[model samples]
Target: MQLVSEFRPKTGDATLDGLLEDAMVRFLSRRPADRQDALEKLWDAFERVKTLEGSNKSVAVPILLGNAALGSDPFRELLTDEFHLLTRVGNNFTIRHHEIGKTPPPSDHARDYLFVRLASVVAVVLRHTGRMA
Candidate 1:
């Protein structure tokens, strides 16, 4: 398990950050085809990371973002796609999936709420990872 603290975001490069976030979003998706497509993006992200000084803390953020994305239940159950970026960051950082909210109400509205909440997390992660927010 990689510690959350170990993952850092690249702070100064706006363009690079956006690319990483886009890659992460694709990787986080719960589809095989999407995962495969995201892998290339992940490679690009890594290239950006390599450009940073080894001492930079922000370099680790991709690992954290990938873990969080892959750890989500839908992504994990597929048992096929793995988060390569997360592994490279180190085993110290671990991504855990938690029920984001209380037991949903028995109505259709509940599902909508859950979707909104999850989407919000994704958005935040993307903005943070991309350095756009």
Candidate 2:
């Protein structure tokens, strides 16, 4: 799974950029735990990236997505679905949290799949929103 040759997202925020960088480095490692940590950092960045313009998540996310979607209703709906689906995955898995009964990725490939999916979404958002070059 080729996530990217270099994962540099110019989100106009240093902390979020650093988090995204760290996640890429950790995700590139061979260890499974590092991959999980990567997911955690990535999801954290994803959550924060939405708030780059405003504080309210509900308001900011839709606006951020609208920026990315660029007046395409179908694409906007797709982005909306992807945002929720990825959020759910992060929440239900052990990658982002370690509460009671969280489930780890089913396998190494599954871990890779999850990482690639979310990372790609993040890249798209940054690109379409003029945050990344």
Candidate 3:
């Protein structure tokens, strides 16, 4: 929880930031059940990347590739049951987008629904973060 609150996206690292965005998009587009199975694997990869401190981006790249190959884990459970990930991503994206203040796409309604779902997850996550973090 606290980890997520503290986890501002690392924009300075353009490559890593792009990878994270791609991973999130992939996860968001997946089916719920498959997302769950895939999320465990994705989380595992993130954990692995955290440890690849000295290996340079090459080490992380494979992990990112593995995550991309695994596909998006739209595991709402991770947001509902877990915490940090959804809230941070949601809150960050919400704030980030608004700050940039771009208009929603042509599919604004659909995008809104997705954003709402993601926000709900973020709310749950924030509560979890308050307790756990």
Candidate 4:
């Protein structure tokens, strides 16, 4: 099992924090075959935070992932590309919006990678928003 010691989000918002914690636990405990669902839940957690902050009204993913608030323009562009790729992977392969018969599920490594990346982004958002000390 991969250890996710750094997958911590201190958003100070009960709902968002709870979701992040639940997703972390699910990712840590679930088997590889069951991890795709966990990844989707993790992405949902991030989305929930974005919605809670009222930052995703016009955007698909969180504005933090694409906005200048994250960093410089080049860095924001990179993060935005990464976020979009992650979203596409979730929608195309994972259980997020894929039909069982139409799309192939992601492998264990892919799921793990997605979880880690999402966790990192969530942590960044928390830190950026002064929710984490």
Candidate 5:
């Protein structure tokens, strides 16, 4: 699977940007034979982007995604539902929950698909937030 060389979203938050870059590095590395590890890292990156403007508050993903500070473009408006769905997918299948034997693990293809989705979301968020020119 092809991976982005860097996950630099540039949300004006240094820590969050660093976290995303780290996650991207892990996802691109070949050491993670188990797709779960890459998914977990990508999930962490997603959560960090979501909470970028929350000041560490326990805000819902939808609320974070809808924040006016992000932008009011039509694309941002359209992304609201997509963000929620991604959150649900992450919660259901990844390490966000301890389902262990209860939930089936994601296949390599599924993991690659999710990675692309997440990369798109992060890129959109950065562009909308005026972080990306």
Candidate 6:
């Protein structure tokens, strides 16, 4: 499967779009550091996109995700779960920070997996909120 291609969507917010674009560009590098950077930027964008709806972060996330409005209950649950998982990975890993106990992604495959997984949810939220097109 393709992680990123020529058809990346616009996130409307210039900063957010740049974050996503930069993440994709960084992911193109073969270096492990670059992949980690990609996840960092993607996660940053993910947090910022949740606030686009004028609601507080906690309230806005569910609105941004949209409850059962995308298609069905399963899809909604999947998206919500994915978002939470991404957030947890960011918090627990060395992608964002390297303080004391955070662990870096084990391999190149794992790094790539993280970048793509996080980016997917960020893109979906942007699209659902009309921030992406």
Q: Which candidate is the best by TM-score?
A: 2
lDDT of 6 by residue, 1-133 (tens): 3537642657567887788888888888888788778888888877777777654988877776773247667877888898788888888898777889999889889888888777777666665656555
Pairs clashing in candidate 1? 1-92, 1-93, 2-92, 2-93, 2-94, 3-92, 3-93, 8-58, 8-60, 8-61
- Over 58-77, each residue of candidate 1 has an lDDT whose tens digit, in order, gives 56544545444445656433
Better of 2 and 3 by lDDT: 2
Task: Give each model a TM-score.
Answer: 0.34, 0.93, 0.25, 0.72, 0.71, 0.86
* TM accuracy, model 6: 0.86
In candidate 6, where is summed lDDT lowest over 10 consecutive residues? 1-10
Model 4 reaches what TM-score against the true structure? 0.72
Error of 2 at 83 (Å): 0.3
Per-candidate Cα RMSD to the true structure, in Å, reads 14.6, 1.4, 14.6, 3.3, 3.6, 2.1
Cα lDDT of candidate 6 equals 0.75
lDDT of each: 0.42, 0.87, 0.38, 0.64, 0.66, 0.75
Return the top candidate by lDDT: 2
lDDT value for candidate 5?
Answer: 0.66
Please write out the lDDT profile of model 2 over residues 2-121, one tens digit for every residue: 546566678779999999999999988999889888888988998898797798989999998998998999999999999999888888998778899999888989988988998999
Q: How should the candidates be ordered by TM-score, best one leading?
A: 2, 6, 4, 5, 1, 3
Candidate 6 Cα outliers beyond 4 Å, as residue runs: 1-3, 67-71
Candidate 3 stretches greater than 4 Å from native: 1-8, 30-48, 51-53, 56-133
The CA lDDT at 45 in model 4 is 76
How should the candidates be ordered by lDDT, best one leading? 2, 6, 5, 4, 1, 3
The stretch of ten residues in a row with the least summed lDDT in candidate 1 is 89-98
Span of 10 residues, lowest total lDDT, candidate 5? 60-69
What would you estimate as the lDDT of candidate 3?
0.38
lDDT of 4: 0.64
The reply for model 2, stretches above 4 Å from the true place, is: 1-3
Candidate 5, residues 6-107: lDDT per residue as tens digits? 445667777767766676766776664644565676677777777766646356445555653355656556777677787787788745667664453556
lDDT, candidate 3, 18-70, per-residue tens: 44344344445546543332333333334333333335655643343333333
